[model samples]
Target: MSRPAVLAARLRTAAWLGWQIEANWADPFTFIVYSAVRPLATALILAVMYRAVAGIASSGQAFLGFYVANAFHEYVIRVLVGMGWVIVEEREEFETLKFVYTSPIGMFTYLWGRSSVKFVQASLSLLLILTTGWLILGLRWDWGAVRWLPLLLSFVLGLIAIVYFGFFVAGWALVLPRAAISVNEGVAAALTLLCGVIFPIDLLPRAVQVVAMLLPFTWWYEALRRFLIGHGASARLSSFSDGALLAALAVSTALFSCVSVWGYGVLERRARQNGKLDQARLF
Candidate 1:
Protein backbone atom coordinates (compact mmCIF):
# COMPACT_ATOMS: atom_id res chain seq x y z
CA MET A 1 0.00 0.00 0.00
CA SER A 2 1.03 3.60 -0.47
CA ARG A 3 2.11 5.41 2.68
CA PRO A 4 -1.02 7.56 2.83
CA ALA A 5 -3.26 4.57 2.12
CA VAL A 6 -1.57 2.57 4.86
CA LEU A 7 -2.06 5.41 7.32
CA ALA A 8 -5.71 5.73 6.40
CA ALA A 9 -6.24 1.99 6.81
CA ARG A 10 -4.65 2.04 10.26
CA LEU A 11 -6.76 4.97 11.39
CA ARG A 12 -9.89 3.22 10.20
CA THR A 13 -8.91 0.09 12.06
CA ALA A 14 -8.25 2.09 15.22
CA ALA A 15 -11.65 3.73 15.03
CA TRP A 16 -13.35 0.40 14.43
CA LEU A 17 -11.56 -1.14 17.40
CA GLY A 18 -12.73 1.72 19.57
CA TRP A 19 -16.35 1.19 18.53
CA GLN A 20 -16.16 -2.55 19.10
CA ILE A 21 -14.77 -2.02 22.57
CA GLU A 22 -17.59 0.32 23.46
CA ALA A 23 -20.27 -1.90 21.98
CA ASN A 24 -18.96 -5.08 23.57
CA TRP A 25 -18.68 -3.47 26.99
CA ALA A 26 -22.18 -2.02 27.11
CA ASP A 27 -25.27 -1.29 25.08
CA PRO A 28 -25.87 2.17 23.73
CA PHE A 29 -28.50 2.99 26.34
CA THR A 30 -26.30 1.80 29.19
CA PHE A 31 -23.31 3.76 27.96
CA ILE A 32 -25.41 6.87 27.64
CA VAL A 33 -26.93 6.37 31.09
CA TYR A 34 -23.61 5.88 32.82
CA SER A 35 -21.98 8.84 31.11
CA ALA A 36 -24.89 11.10 32.01
CA VAL A 37 -25.22 9.90 35.60
CA ARG A 38 -21.56 9.81 36.58
CA PRO A 39 -20.69 13.43 35.77
CA LEU A 40 -24.05 14.82 36.85
CA ALA A 41 -23.84 13.06 40.19
CA THR A 42 -20.34 14.36 40.80
CA ALA A 43 -21.39 17.89 39.85
CA LEU A 44 -24.39 17.81 42.19
CA ILE A 45 -22.25 16.62 45.06
CA LEU A 46 -19.77 19.42 44.43
CA ALA A 47 -22.58 21.94 44.17
CA VAL A 48 -23.86 20.90 47.56
CA MET A 49 -20.37 21.09 49.03
CA TYR A 50 -19.87 24.54 47.56
CA ARG A 51 -23.17 25.72 48.96
CA ALA A 52 -22.34 24.33 52.37
CA VAL A 53 -18.98 26.06 52.47
CA ALA A 54 -19.96 29.37 50.86
CA GLY A 55 -23.62 29.55 51.91
CA ILE A 56 -26.25 28.85 49.26
CA ALA A 57 -27.88 32.26 49.37
CA SER A 58 -24.58 34.11 49.45
CA SER A 59 -22.89 32.17 46.68
CA GLY A 60 -25.25 33.56 44.00
CA GLN A 61 -25.19 33.37 40.19
CA ALA A 62 -21.48 33.93 39.64
CA PHE A 63 -20.54 30.97 41.76
CA LEU A 64 -23.15 28.75 40.14
CA GLY A 65 -22.01 29.73 36.68
CA PHE A 66 -18.39 29.03 37.47
CA TYR A 67 -19.22 25.75 39.14
CA VAL A 68 -21.32 24.54 36.24
CA ALA A 69 -18.76 25.59 33.66
CA ASN A 70 -15.98 23.95 35.64
CA ALA A 71 -18.01 20.78 36.01
CA PHE A 72 -18.31 20.51 32.24
CA HIS A 73 -14.59 21.07 31.82
CA GLU A 74 -13.88 18.47 34.50
CA TYR A 75 -15.95 15.96 32.56
CA VAL A 76 -13.80 16.65 29.53
CA ILE A 77 -10.64 16.00 31.52
CA ARG A 78 -12.01 12.77 32.98
CA VAL A 79 -12.98 11.51 29.56
CA LEU A 80 -9.55 12.33 28.18
CA VAL A 81 -7.90 10.41 31.03
CA GLY A 82 -10.34 7.62 30.47
CA MET A 83 -9.09 7.43 26.90
CA GLY A 84 -5.59 6.68 28.19
CA TRP A 85 -6.93 4.12 30.64
CA VAL A 86 -8.66 2.32 27.79
CA ILE A 87 -5.27 1.70 26.22
CA VAL A 88 -3.89 0.49 29.54
CA GLU A 89 -6.79 -1.87 30.04
CA GLU A 90 -6.31 -3.38 26.61
CA ARG A 91 -2.67 -4.03 27.35
CA GLU A 92 -3.13 -5.52 30.81
CA GLU A 93 -6.52 -7.17 30.87
CA PHE A 94 -7.02 -8.17 27.26
CA GLU A 95 -3.40 -9.19 26.72
CA THR A 96 -3.25 -7.38 23.40
CA LEU A 97 -0.09 -5.40 24.03
CA LYS A 98 2.15 -7.62 21.94
CA PHE A 99 0.02 -7.33 18.83
CA VAL A 100 -0.32 -3.58 19.24
CA TYR A 101 3.41 -3.25 19.86
CA THR A 102 4.21 -5.12 16.66
CA SER A 103 1.50 -3.64 14.44
CA PRO A 104 2.51 -2.21 11.04
CA ILE A 105 0.60 1.00 11.66
CA GLY A 106 2.39 1.64 14.97
CA MET A 107 1.12 2.17 18.50
CA PHE A 108 1.12 5.95 18.24
CA THR A 109 -1.24 6.00 15.28
CA TYR A 110 -3.48 3.40 16.90
CA LEU A 111 -3.74 5.49 20.05
CA TRP A 112 -4.48 8.62 18.08
CA GLY A 113 -7.44 7.00 16.36
CA ARG A 114 -8.76 5.51 19.61
CA SER A 115 -8.41 8.81 21.45
CA SER A 116 -10.15 10.59 18.58
CA VAL A 117 -13.19 8.38 19.12
CA LYS A 118 -13.08 9.09 22.84
CA PHE A 119 -13.01 12.80 22.07
CA VAL A 120 -16.33 12.48 20.28
CA GLN A 121 -17.75 10.47 23.15
CA ALA A 122 -16.54 13.05 25.62
CA SER A 123 -18.08 15.86 23.59
CA LEU A 124 -21.41 14.09 23.81
CA SER A 125 -21.02 13.78 27.55
CA LEU A 126 -20.29 17.49 27.79
CA LEU A 127 -23.47 18.31 25.88
CA LEU A 128 -25.49 16.04 28.11
CA ILE A 129 -24.09 17.69 31.23
CA LEU A 130 -24.82 21.15 29.89
CA THR A 131 -28.40 20.25 29.04
CA THR A 132 -28.99 18.60 32.40
CA GLY A 133 -27.50 21.52 34.29
CA TRP A 134 -29.63 23.98 32.40
CA LEU A 135 -32.84 22.05 33.03
CA ILE A 136 -32.29 20.73 36.54
CA LEU A 137 -29.99 23.26 38.16
CA GLY A 138 -31.14 26.46 36.46
CA LEU A 139 -27.71 27.04 34.96
CA ARG A 140 -27.89 29.73 32.32
CA TRP A 141 -25.58 31.08 29.61
CA ASP A 142 -26.30 33.65 26.98
CA TRP A 143 -25.73 31.55 23.89
CA GLY A 144 -26.52 34.49 21.65
CA ALA A 145 -23.88 36.66 23.29
CA VAL A 146 -21.11 34.11 22.72
CA ARG A 147 -18.75 34.76 19.79
CA TRP A 148 -19.45 31.60 17.82
CA LEU A 149 -16.41 31.72 15.55
CA PRO A 150 -13.90 32.12 18.35
CA LEU A 151 -15.77 29.59 20.46
CA LEU A 152 -15.51 26.99 17.65
CA LEU A 153 -11.85 27.78 17.21
CA SER A 154 -11.29 27.44 20.93
CA PHE A 155 -13.12 24.12 21.03
CA VAL A 156 -11.03 22.71 18.19
CA LEU A 157 -7.76 23.87 19.74
CA GLY A 158 -8.72 22.78 23.24
CA LEU A 159 -9.84 19.31 22.14
CA ILE A 160 -6.69 18.83 20.09
CA ALA A 161 -4.58 19.82 23.09
CA ILE A 162 -6.50 17.44 25.34
CA VAL A 163 -6.31 14.56 22.86
CA TYR A 164 -2.56 15.06 22.64
CA PHE A 165 -2.45 14.99 26.44
CA GLY A 166 -4.21 11.64 26.29
CA PHE A 167 -1.58 10.39 23.85
CA PHE A 168 1.13 11.42 26.33
CA VAL A 169 -0.59 9.48 29.09
CA ALA A 170 -1.03 6.50 26.78
CA GLY A 171 2.73 6.39 26.34
CA TRP A 172 3.23 6.13 30.10
CA ALA A 173 0.66 3.33 30.19
CA LEU A 174 2.66 1.40 27.62
CA VAL A 175 5.76 1.13 29.82
CA LEU A 176 4.56 1.60 33.39
CA PRO A 177 1.28 -0.22 33.57
CA ARG A 178 0.77 -0.08 37.33
CA ALA A 179 2.24 3.38 37.77
CA ALA A 180 0.06 4.68 34.96
CA ILE A 181 -3.02 4.21 37.13
CA SER A 182 -1.64 6.46 39.85
CA VAL A 183 -0.30 8.85 37.25
CA ASN A 184 -3.70 9.31 35.60
CA GLU A 185 -5.46 9.69 38.95
CA GLY A 186 -2.86 12.14 40.22
CA VAL A 187 -3.09 14.19 37.02
CA ALA A 188 -6.89 14.36 37.23
CA ALA A 189 -6.77 15.40 40.87
CA ALA A 190 -3.99 17.92 40.29
CA LEU A 191 -5.81 19.50 37.34
CA THR A 192 -8.97 19.80 39.40
CA LEU A 193 -7.13 21.68 42.12
CA LEU A 194 -4.63 23.59 40.01
CA CYS A 195 -6.30 24.21 36.64
CA GLY A 196 -9.04 26.57 37.81
CA VAL A 197 -11.70 23.95 37.07
CA ILE A 198 -14.06 24.65 39.96
CA PHE A 199 -12.40 27.75 41.37
CA PRO A 200 -10.59 30.81 40.07
CA ILE A 201 -6.85 30.19 39.63
CA ASP A 202 -6.10 33.41 41.48
CA LEU A 203 -7.42 31.88 44.70
CA LEU A 204 -4.60 29.32 44.73
CA PRO A 205 -1.27 30.17 46.38
CA ARG A 206 1.32 32.02 44.31
CA ALA A 207 3.62 29.00 44.01
CA VAL A 208 0.79 26.69 43.01
CA GLN A 209 -0.59 29.34 40.66
CA VAL A 210 2.76 29.49 38.91
CA VAL A 211 2.66 25.72 38.38
CA ALA A 212 -0.91 25.90 37.13
CA MET A 213 0.04 28.38 34.43
CA LEU A 214 2.48 25.83 33.03
CA LEU A 215 -0.28 23.27 32.39
CA PRO A 216 -2.38 23.23 29.23
CA PHE A 217 -5.50 22.33 31.21
CA THR A 218 -5.41 25.73 32.88
CA TRP A 219 -5.40 27.56 29.59
CA TRP A 220 -7.95 25.27 27.93
CA TYR A 221 -10.37 25.69 30.81
CA GLU A 222 -9.86 29.45 30.91
CA ALA A 223 -10.31 29.80 27.15
CA LEU A 224 -13.46 27.68 27.10
CA ARG A 225 -14.87 29.50 30.09
CA ARG A 226 -14.09 32.89 28.63
CA PHE A 227 -15.81 31.93 25.39
CA LEU A 228 -18.80 30.35 27.08
CA ILE A 229 -19.33 32.74 29.96
CA GLY A 230 -17.18 35.87 29.44
CA HIS A 231 -13.74 37.24 30.27
CA GLY A 232 -14.85 38.74 33.57
CA ALA A 233 -16.13 35.39 34.81
CA SER A 234 -13.07 33.45 33.69
CA ALA A 235 -10.44 35.56 35.48
CA ARG A 236 -6.91 34.13 35.63
CA LEU A 237 -4.43 33.85 38.48
CA SER A 238 -1.61 34.89 36.17
CA SER A 239 -1.09 38.26 34.48
CA PHE A 240 -1.02 36.66 31.02
CA SER A 241 -3.08 38.16 28.22
CA ASP A 242 -5.64 36.29 26.07
CA GLY A 243 -3.19 36.03 23.17
CA ALA A 244 -0.58 34.63 25.54
CA LEU A 245 -2.96 31.96 26.85
CA LEU A 246 -3.83 30.72 23.36
CA ALA A 247 -0.19 30.73 22.38
CA ALA A 248 0.68 28.74 25.50
CA LEU A 249 -1.97 26.17 24.64
CA ALA A 250 -0.56 25.76 21.14
CA VAL A 251 2.97 25.42 22.45
CA SER A 252 1.94 23.05 25.22
CA THR A 253 0.08 20.78 22.81
CA ALA A 254 2.99 20.67 20.40
CA LEU A 255 5.44 19.98 23.22
CA PHE A 256 3.33 17.16 24.58
CA SER A 257 2.94 15.66 21.11
CA CYS A 258 6.69 15.56 20.68
CA VAL A 259 7.15 14.11 24.15
CA SER A 260 4.54 11.44 23.55
CA VAL A 261 6.20 10.43 20.30
CA TRP A 262 9.56 10.25 22.04
CA GLY A 263 8.11 8.33 24.95
CA TYR A 264 6.50 5.80 22.64
CA GLY A 265 9.84 5.25 20.91
CA VAL A 266 11.53 4.73 24.27
CA LEU A 267 8.91 2.25 25.35
CA GLU A 268 9.12 0.36 22.10
CA ARG A 269 12.89 0.13 22.34
CA ARG A 270 12.81 -0.96 25.97
CA ALA A 271 10.10 -3.50 25.32
CA ARG A 272 12.08 -5.01 22.46
CA GLN A 273 15.30 -5.16 24.49
CA ASN A 274 13.70 -6.55 27.66
CA GLY A 275 11.11 -8.82 25.98
CA LYS A 276 8.39 -7.25 28.13
CA LEU A 277 5.76 -6.44 25.55
CA ASP A 278 3.96 -9.74 26.00
CA GLN A 279 4.73 -10.10 29.69
CA ALA A 280 1.67 -9.86 31.91
CA ARG A 281 3.34 -7.74 34.57
CA LEU A 282 6.59 -5.78 34.77
CA PHE A 283 6.92 -6.00 38.51
Candidate 2:
Protein backbone atom coordinates (compact mmCIF):
# COMPACT_ATOMS: atom_id res chain seq x y z
CA MET A 1 0.00 0.00 0.00
CA SER A 2 1.05 3.59 -0.58
CA ARG A 3 2.22 5.48 2.51
CA PRO A 4 -0.92 7.62 2.67
CA ALA A 5 -3.05 4.58 2.02
CA VAL A 6 -1.35 2.80 4.88
CA LEU A 7 -1.89 5.78 7.13
CA ALA A 8 -5.54 6.00 6.24
CA ALA A 9 -6.01 2.31 6.82
CA ARG A 10 -4.38 2.52 10.22
CA LEU A 11 -6.58 5.44 11.18
CA ARG A 12 -9.69 3.62 10.11
CA THR A 13 -8.61 0.56 12.02
CA ALA A 14 -7.94 2.67 15.07
CA ALA A 15 -11.39 4.19 14.88
CA TRP A 16 -13.08 0.84 14.54
CA LEU A 17 -11.10 -0.59 17.44
CA GLY A 18 -11.69 2.50 19.56
CA TRP A 19 -15.41 2.17 19.10
CA GLN A 20 -15.28 -1.47 20.09
CA ILE A 21 -13.48 -0.67 23.32
CA GLU A 22 -15.78 2.22 24.07
CA ALA A 23 -18.80 0.05 23.60
CA ASN A 24 -17.58 -1.91 26.61
CA TRP A 25 -17.52 1.12 28.86
CA ALA A 26 -18.89 0.34 32.28
CA ASP A 27 -22.66 0.24 32.57
CA PRO A 28 -24.38 3.37 33.88
CA PHE A 29 -24.30 2.51 37.55
CA THR A 30 -20.79 1.06 37.43
CA PHE A 31 -19.53 4.05 35.55
CA ILE A 32 -21.01 6.51 37.98
CA VAL A 33 -20.02 4.62 41.11
CA TYR A 34 -16.50 3.69 40.06
CA SER A 35 -15.52 6.79 38.15
CA ALA A 36 -16.97 9.41 40.48
CA VAL A 37 -16.43 7.88 43.89
CA ARG A 38 -12.73 8.33 44.57
CA PRO A 39 -12.39 11.82 43.21
CA LEU A 40 -15.54 12.93 45.05
CA ALA A 41 -14.17 11.60 48.31
CA THR A 42 -10.82 13.19 47.65
CA ALA A 43 -12.42 16.50 46.86
CA LEU A 44 -14.42 16.42 50.05
CA ILE A 45 -11.37 15.57 52.13
CA LEU A 46 -9.40 18.41 50.55
CA ALA A 47 -12.26 20.81 51.12
CA VAL A 48 -12.30 20.09 54.80
CA MET A 49 -8.53 20.25 55.02
CA TYR A 50 -8.39 23.55 53.19
CA ARG A 51 -11.23 24.99 55.26
CA ALA A 52 -9.33 24.10 58.43
CA VAL A 53 -6.13 25.70 57.20
CA ALA A 54 -7.91 28.77 55.89
CA GLY A 55 -9.69 29.30 59.20
CA ILE A 56 -6.45 30.27 60.85
CA ALA A 57 -4.71 31.87 57.87
CA SER A 58 -5.47 34.00 54.82
CA SER A 59 -8.07 32.46 52.50
CA GLY A 60 -6.85 31.27 49.10
CA GLN A 61 -8.28 29.36 46.18
CA ALA A 62 -4.94 27.86 45.11
CA PHE A 63 -5.32 24.70 47.21
CA LEU A 64 -8.80 24.07 45.99
CA GLY A 65 -7.70 24.50 42.39
CA PHE A 66 -4.61 22.39 42.88
CA TYR A 67 -6.53 19.61 44.58
CA VAL A 68 -9.15 19.39 41.86
CA ALA A 69 -6.57 19.51 39.07
CA ASN A 70 -4.25 16.94 40.61
CA ALA A 71 -7.03 14.56 41.53
CA PHE A 72 -8.47 14.77 38.03
CA HIS A 73 -5.00 14.40 36.54
CA GLU A 74 -4.34 11.32 38.67
CA TYR A 75 -7.53 9.74 37.40
CA VAL A 76 -6.30 10.38 33.87
CA ILE A 77 -3.07 8.63 34.74
CA ARG A 78 -5.03 5.68 36.09
CA VAL A 79 -6.83 5.35 32.77
CA LEU A 80 -3.60 5.53 30.81
CA VAL A 81 -1.86 2.93 32.94
CA GLY A 82 -4.80 0.57 33.15
CA MET A 83 -5.42 0.66 29.43
CA GLY A 84 -1.84 -0.45 28.88
CA TRP A 85 -2.57 -3.78 30.52
CA VAL A 86 -5.93 -4.61 29.00
CA ILE A 87 -4.12 -6.60 26.36
CA VAL A 88 -3.11 -8.90 29.15
CA GLU A 89 -6.70 -9.36 30.14
CA GLU A 90 -7.41 -10.46 26.60
CA ARG A 91 -4.42 -12.76 26.61
CA GLU A 92 -5.57 -14.46 29.78
CA GLU A 93 -9.17 -14.88 28.76
CA PHE A 94 -8.92 -16.00 25.15
CA GLU A 95 -5.29 -15.80 24.07
CA THR A 96 -5.94 -12.62 22.14
CA LEU A 97 -2.26 -11.82 22.10
CA LYS A 98 -1.75 -14.47 19.44
CA PHE A 99 -4.45 -12.90 17.33
CA VAL A 100 -2.84 -9.50 17.79
CA TYR A 101 0.49 -10.98 16.81
CA THR A 102 -0.99 -12.24 13.55
CA SER A 103 -3.17 -9.28 12.69
CA PRO A 104 -2.88 -7.64 9.25
CA ILE A 105 -2.65 -4.07 10.39
CA GLY A 106 0.11 -2.82 12.62
CA MET A 107 -0.37 -3.58 16.31
CA PHE A 108 -0.02 0.08 17.15
CA THR A 109 -3.20 0.98 15.34
CA TYR A 110 -5.25 -1.60 17.15
CA LEU A 111 -3.67 -0.70 20.47
CA TRP A 112 -4.38 2.97 19.86
CA GLY A 113 -8.04 2.29 19.34
CA ARG A 114 -8.27 0.24 22.50
CA SER A 115 -6.29 2.62 24.69
CA SER A 116 -7.99 5.73 23.38
CA VAL A 117 -11.39 4.30 24.19
CA LYS A 118 -10.28 3.27 27.67
CA PHE A 119 -8.77 6.70 28.29
CA VAL A 120 -12.08 8.32 27.47
CA GLN A 121 -13.80 5.93 29.85
CA ALA A 122 -11.36 6.69 32.66
CA SER A 123 -11.53 10.46 32.06
CA LEU A 124 -15.29 10.39 32.48
CA SER A 125 -14.76 9.98 36.21
CA LEU A 126 -12.64 13.10 36.45
CA LEU A 127 -15.10 15.06 34.38
CA LEU A 128 -17.81 14.28 36.87
CA ILE A 129 -15.58 15.17 39.81
CA LEU A 130 -14.41 18.51 38.39
CA THR A 131 -17.82 19.58 37.14
CA THR A 132 -19.52 18.77 40.42
CA GLY A 133 -16.86 20.53 42.44
CA TRP A 134 -16.86 23.54 40.18
CA LEU A 135 -20.63 24.01 40.06
CA ILE A 136 -21.84 22.71 43.39
CA LEU A 137 -18.95 23.53 45.69
CA GLY A 138 -18.59 27.07 44.30
CA LEU A 139 -15.07 26.51 43.03
CA ARG A 140 -14.15 29.40 40.79
CA TRP A 141 -13.55 28.95 37.10
CA ASP A 142 -10.98 31.30 35.56
CA TRP A 143 -13.13 31.75 32.42
CA GLY A 144 -10.10 32.57 30.24
CA ALA A 145 -10.51 31.46 26.65
CA VAL A 146 -6.89 31.30 25.53
CA ARG A 147 -5.16 30.90 28.85
CA TRP A 148 -6.62 27.46 29.28
CA LEU A 149 -5.08 26.05 26.11
CA PRO A 150 -2.33 24.31 28.04
CA LEU A 151 -4.89 22.31 29.95
CA LEU A 152 -6.04 20.62 26.77
CA LEU A 153 -2.45 20.22 25.67
CA SER A 154 -1.48 18.51 28.91
CA PHE A 155 -4.41 16.13 28.62
CA VAL A 156 -3.39 15.13 25.10
CA LEU A 157 0.22 14.72 26.17
CA GLY A 158 -0.78 12.60 29.13
CA LEU A 159 -2.84 10.38 26.85
CA ILE A 160 0.07 9.88 24.50
CA ALA A 161 2.38 9.02 27.36
CA ILE A 162 -0.02 6.33 28.50
CA VAL A 163 0.09 4.77 25.05
CA TYR A 164 3.87 4.64 25.13
CA PHE A 165 3.89 3.17 28.60
CA GLY A 166 1.32 0.63 27.51
CA PHE A 167 3.67 -0.50 24.78
CA PHE A 168 6.27 -1.41 27.38
CA VAL A 169 3.72 -3.37 29.35
CA ALA A 170 2.41 -5.19 26.31
CA GLY A 171 5.93 -5.98 25.17
CA TRP A 172 6.76 -7.43 28.57
CA ALA A 173 3.70 -9.64 28.38
CA LEU A 174 4.80 -10.89 24.99
CA VAL A 175 8.41 -11.54 25.97
CA LEU A 176 8.00 -12.93 29.49
CA PRO A 177 5.64 -15.83 29.93
CA ARG A 178 4.02 -14.57 33.13
CA ALA A 179 4.95 -10.91 33.26
CA ALA A 180 1.57 -9.19 32.87
CA ILE A 181 0.64 -9.08 36.53
CA SER A 182 3.81 -7.34 37.60
CA VAL A 183 3.74 -5.02 34.62
CA ASN A 184 0.19 -4.00 35.45
CA GLU A 185 0.48 -3.41 39.19
CA GLY A 186 4.09 -2.31 39.16
CA VAL A 187 3.55 0.45 36.60
CA ALA A 188 0.31 1.52 38.25
CA ALA A 189 1.74 1.71 41.76
CA ALA A 190 4.99 3.32 40.68
CA LEU A 191 3.15 5.99 38.74
CA THR A 192 0.66 6.71 41.50
CA LEU A 193 3.42 7.03 44.08
CA LEU A 194 5.78 9.11 41.96
CA CYS A 195 3.29 11.16 39.96
CA GLY A 196 2.51 13.65 42.74
CA VAL A 197 -0.99 12.27 43.16
CA ILE A 198 -1.47 12.08 46.90
CA PHE A 199 1.25 14.64 47.59
CA PRO A 200 3.25 16.96 45.34
CA ILE A 201 6.86 15.95 44.72
CA ASP A 202 8.13 19.26 46.08
CA LEU A 203 7.04 18.04 49.49
CA LEU A 204 9.09 14.88 49.16
CA PRO A 205 12.72 14.43 50.21
CA ARG A 206 15.27 15.85 47.80
CA ALA A 207 16.50 12.47 46.59
CA VAL A 208 13.02 11.08 46.02
CA GLN A 209 11.97 14.24 44.21
CA VAL A 210 14.96 13.95 41.88
CA VAL A 211 14.04 10.36 41.07
CA ALA A 212 10.41 11.26 40.53
CA MET A 213 11.42 14.00 38.11
CA LEU A 214 13.00 11.37 35.88
CA LEU A 215 9.62 9.71 35.27
CA PRO A 216 7.14 10.98 32.68
CA PHE A 217 4.32 11.15 35.23
CA THR A 218 5.82 14.15 37.03
CA TRP A 219 6.01 16.20 33.83
CA TRP A 220 2.48 15.14 32.92
CA TYR A 221 1.16 16.15 36.33
CA GLU A 222 3.11 19.41 36.42
CA ALA A 223 1.92 20.37 32.95
CA LEU A 224 -1.62 19.53 34.01
CA ARG A 225 -1.38 21.73 37.10
CA ARG A 226 0.00 24.65 35.11
CA PHE A 227 -2.59 24.38 32.35
CA LEU A 228 -5.64 23.93 34.55
CA ILE A 229 -4.59 26.75 36.85
CA GLY A 230 -3.76 29.25 34.10
CA HIS A 231 -0.01 29.35 34.69
CA GLY A 232 0.77 32.03 32.10
CA ALA A 233 -2.05 34.41 32.92
CA SER A 234 0.35 37.33 33.32
CA ALA A 235 1.50 37.08 29.70
CA ARG A 236 -0.09 39.19 26.96
CA LEU A 237 -0.93 36.18 24.80
CA SER A 238 -1.60 33.66 27.48
CA SER A 239 -3.66 31.63 25.07
CA PHE A 240 -0.77 31.49 22.63
CA SER A 241 1.54 30.18 25.33
CA ASP A 242 -1.01 27.56 26.23
CA GLY A 243 -1.16 26.42 22.62
CA ALA A 244 2.62 26.40 22.42
CA LEU A 245 2.83 24.22 25.51
CA LEU A 246 0.30 21.83 24.04
CA ALA A 247 2.25 21.64 20.79
CA ALA A 248 5.49 21.00 22.67
CA LEU A 249 3.89 18.27 24.75
CA ALA A 250 2.34 16.70 21.68
CA VAL A 251 5.75 16.52 20.00
CA SER A 252 7.40 15.08 23.10
CA THR A 253 4.68 12.46 23.40
CA ALA A 254 5.11 11.44 19.77
CA LEU A 255 8.85 11.04 20.23
CA PHE A 256 8.54 8.88 23.33
CA SER A 257 5.74 6.86 21.79
CA CYS A 258 7.84 6.04 18.74
CA VAL A 259 10.72 4.83 20.84
CA SER A 260 8.58 2.74 23.18
CA VAL A 261 6.53 1.18 20.41
CA TRP A 262 9.64 0.28 18.44
CA GLY A 263 11.13 -1.36 21.50
CA TYR A 264 7.98 -3.41 22.12
CA GLY A 265 7.86 -4.57 18.49
CA VAL A 266 11.42 -5.76 18.63
CA LEU A 267 10.77 -7.77 21.80
CA GLU A 268 7.52 -9.26 20.54
CA ARG A 269 9.09 -10.37 17.28
CA ARG A 270 11.94 -12.01 19.13
CA ALA A 271 9.50 -13.88 21.34
CA ARG A 272 7.78 -15.29 18.27
CA GLN A 273 11.11 -16.51 16.89
CA ASN A 274 11.76 -18.45 20.10
CA GLY A 275 8.25 -19.95 20.46
CA LYS A 276 7.72 -18.01 23.68
CA LEU A 277 4.61 -16.10 22.68
CA ASP A 278 2.39 -18.86 24.01
CA GLN A 279 3.80 -18.32 27.46
CA ALA A 280 1.76 -15.14 27.71
CA ARG A 281 -1.29 -17.23 28.58
CA LEU A 282 -2.58 -17.46 32.14
CA PHE A 283 -3.35 -21.16 31.94
For model 2, which pairs clash?
146-239
Q: Write the per-residue lDDT of candidate 2 for residues 172-232, one digit (tens) a residue.
A: 7666667667777777777767766545566667788676655655666656756565442
Instruction: Return the clash pairs for model 1, or none.
Output: none
Clashes of 1: 0
Relative to the true structure, candidate 1 reaches a TM of 0.86
Prediction 1 global C-alpha lDDT: 0.68
Per-residue error at 257 for model 2, in Å? 3.3
Q: Which stretches of candidate 1 lie over 4 Å from their true place?
A: 25-30, 56-59, 74-79, 232-240, 271-273
lDDT tens per residue, model 1, 1-283: 8999999999988888887776456587877665567777767776777778866631355665566556657445555686567656776778887777676777767877776666666666777767766787776778877877666766777677666667667656666666777877876777788877777778899898888877766777777766676653445533567677678877876676577567667766765677656656533
Q: Relative to the unseen true structure, what is the Cα RMSD of model 1?
A: 2.9
Worst lDDT run of 10 residues, candidate 1, spans: 231-240
Off by over 4 Å in 2: 1-32, 35-62, 74-79, 176-179, 231-255, 273-276, 280-283
